[model samples]
Target: MQYQAVVRKFGPAAEAVEIERAALPVLRRDQVRVRLLARSINPSDIITISGAYAGRTTLPFIPGFEAFGVVEACGEDVYGLAPGTRVLPVRGAGGWQEYKHTDPSWCLRVPDGLSDFEAATSYVNPMTAWLMLHKKIGLRPGMRIAVNAAASSIGSILIGLANAVGVEPVAIVRSEESRARLSGSLEAVIVDRADSDLATGLAGRHGLDAVLDCVGGAHASILAAALKPGGHFVHYGLLSGQSIPPSFWSSHPDIAFSFFHLREWVHSEAMENVQRAYAEVAAQIAAKIIATEVREVFPLEKIRLALQSTLPFRTGGKVLLA
Candidate 1:
């Protein structure tokens, strides 16, 4: 038997979820059964839980987007992957349950040295940061990139990756306090949004090569203004709850826009490419080239409280359900 947090109806994720129990189903020849150890609550998880993706989502869905677990059992055909291996299970309702059954193709093996929380939280932020930097922007040494929401987990990751390769990063945060949270050693330009002329000032600087933004709406427009002609603007998250202004388009036609949805990318990308990407991200984490943070870990039974801790606009570190 397994316990899971189920969403029978969409509304508020915390209020809508109810704990339920079910027995394990028959395992197929290519499937593996993972004993879930931890799951991370992300904005994407909250969006999926709120019926934002109801058209594609099934009812009574499990809401975890990423989780870390141990391979408890594997079917006869699932060779090379043995029992007791730790992993990040994928390709199902998700990992809010006591166990997850997945085919081997999309599941990622957790490398040594990462805690359960780091592996559980790795897929969303770390992978997205890696893809946007590598595949989308093709970032290289000496390029200038601006990151909005610079205090965030993924934001920190982008800065670290940039620092590692000699690319210059411009970090934009909503306040001076948030700016203080960043390390002075990273050799990046730090901007506090409270300064009224800041956005225009960024536009006038030597000019940015790209902007990696998760905060959409008017703020996205502000960030885009800072990009030089033909600069790439990647929009990934919508924390503002408002759409990017039409003025954003009418105002800056030379700036290219891309919306990055991690789930969609994973579903369509070749499994081999997915594995290779995960391997790169895992190596980055293992070597401390980047870091993942967990502010708290709650037991699986505390589903409601854990969801509340991850609500929008409030930030510190990731919260996990175990």
Candidate 2:
């Protein structure tokens, strides 16, 4: 069968992406054939298109991070999965396509009561939020935690999860608009760019217990300093493309630093652990606690414009290939 997908070509402007027709992959033993419904644009997806993510994908690759689909066919050995079952197959780049054949081991049963959009977006961001808080840091109730880029998808999930567990979240955003947008979820919102008096923002307040940082640049040190002694700092992303400043270690000798990569979590955690994470994420999606907030949806034919329009710094929410 012919299928549609976005493909990246190599050149001086190698970052350019294009949509094309391709043959649907055939199913193999231990694999399932999926007809993709929707896929969300992620920062890692953009970096791969720009040829920076891992620098490992050969030229002319498909570009997608996550997708939700219906199983059209399954290998003989696969159990508990069959035709017409909705599932989310964990794959690297090919999820943007119309159909794919992936290992059945990677397909997680999506909650039946969720929309395609919600199922698609829930796997990555929500799972990351769950793993970071519950597994990576082991945050307890009544502890004070902070998050950078509070308006981001994962950051919002962190806030919701923290509040659900009775933990106070100190959300930091670079713009006033972000603070306004996220005002409902966070206990305290600070404008990172305008406020140099960050200590004053936490006045008459207890010390921070942890911090979830995505903008790993000069601000890493600033965020680290705000933490109480023995507080944990987890760095996940480097949207600013800046290295961690040296001062973070020198100025905060007592604060502990840790890195939380979703990729690493997926690889290191046992299959049961991963399944539990996905289950919690699926439940949140069903409850609308973790909603799929799509800023824009682009057809396969408009792949180039979609990528350009939703570059990380410009997009407000997750962009999807619909």
Candidate 3:
């Protein structure tokens, strides 16, 4: 049978992506074939297409971060899932195609009443937000948490989750434009590009519990300075250059720093716990607590356009390839 794929070509903006006919992937005894319904374009997918993520991908490989699809065929040993079940794969690559072959252990069943779009955007961002708040930070009611990039997909969910746990989230955005885009859902504090002024604004701050930092250049150090004594900082993404000042650690002896990769954490957790986390995300979707904004939807024919448009500062919501 024929399937659709987004093919990538690296050149001077000459057909960077193209929709091509491909054969359906075969399902192994430990795998299942998924008929994709929707897939979201994340920043990671952008880097992959730009040739910056070549280390993690082979040439001409399918590129996608997260997607929701229906199971077309299940392997003999796949018991928890069956044909027609809506599911999402665990990892961040190769969900952009029309059909995908994935290990049964990596698939999470989508709960009833959740739309394909919601499920498509569920696995990466929301799960990261939930894990950072509940597991790594151990934020409790009345505690204060700080999140950089608070207007992005993960940042949006962070605000919602913090509010649910009664933790006050101080949202940090890079520009005045970003600061203006946030809703009045949480207590937001905007950060300017000038470190001198930004540091002055946050000086003498105490009782700051945790910092969820995505930018890792000079910005991480600024965030480190804002933390209270004995506070924790979770470094997940390096949107900025991946280096930080040495003085950050030396100056703050009471503060701690650690990195978190959701893929590593998911693989370590039990299967039952992963299933429970999927259910929780579905519930949050149904309740409108966690919402994904789809900036645009591209059909198979427009895969090239879809891939090119997912760059930073160009789109506001998640870009989906359907």
What is candidate 1's lDDT per residue for 1-322, written digit by digit as tens? 8788999999888788898888888888999988999898887778888899899999988888888999999999998888999888767567899988898776787887887777887788999999999999998987888887888888888888887788758777776677777752344555645546456547555467899988787777777877889999999987667889888888989998899988789989897788889989988988887887778889998888887777753557888888
TM-score of each: 0.94, 0.91, 0.90
Clashing pairs in 3: none
Q: List model 2 lDDT by residue over 70-138, tens digit each.
A: 999988888877899888887566777888888776777887888878887988788888888888779
- Candidate 3 at residue 1, lDDT? 58
After superposition, the stretches of candidate 2 with alpha carbons farther than 4 Å from their true spots are 4-15, 194-206
Q: By lDDT, is 1 or 2 better?
A: 1
Best by lDDT: 1
- For model 1, state the Cα shift of residue 205 in Å: 1.9
Lowest-lDDT window of 10 residues in candidate 2? Answer: 5-14
The local distance difference test score of model 3 is 0.77
Question: How many residue pairs clash per model?
Answer: 0, 0, 0
Clashing pairs in 1: none
Instruction: Count clashing residue pairs in model 3.
Output: 0
Q: Residue 250: error of model 1 in Å? A: 3.0
> In terms of TM-score, which candidate is strongest?
1
